[model samples]
Target: MGGESNRSLSLLHESQNKINSSKDVFLEKCL
Candidate 1:
């Protein structure tokens, strides 16, 4: 159970980083 939770947490963090990078690219294009 603990390992499963850690895996999901890492996945969530990875997705969050992708979202943040995409947002940065979008802002750059808007400017």
Candidate 2:
């Protein structure tokens, strides 16, 4: 159970990073 939750957390973190990077790209284009 602990291992499964850890994997989920990492996956969420990766997705969060992807979202942040995409937002940055969008902001650059808006400028």
Candidate 3:
């Protein structure tokens, strides 16, 4: 159970990072 939770948390963090990077790119283009 602990391992499963850790995997899920890592996946979520990765997705969030991707989203933030994309947002940064979009804002840079707008500038």
Expressed as tens digits, the lDDT of each residue in 1-31 for candidate 1 is: 9999999999999999999999999999999
TM-score of each: 0.93, 0.91, 0.94
lDDT for model 3 comes to 1.00
Q: Write the per-residue lDDT of candidate 3 for residues 2-31, one digit (tens) a residue.
A: 999999999999999999999999999999
Local distance difference test, each candidate: 1.00, 1.00, 1.00
Order by TM-score, highest first: 3, 1, 2
Task: Return the TM-score for candidate 1, rounded to 2 decimals.
Answer: 0.93
lDDT of 2 at 26: 100
Give residue 21's lDDT in candidate 3 (0 to 100): 100
Clashing residue pairs in candidate 2 are none
Q: What digit string (tens of lDDT, one per residue) describes model 2 on residues 1-31?
A: 9999999999999999999999999999999
List the candidate 1 regions with Cα displacement exceeding 4 Å: none
Q: Give the CA lDDT, 0 to 100, for residue 24 in model 1.
A: 100
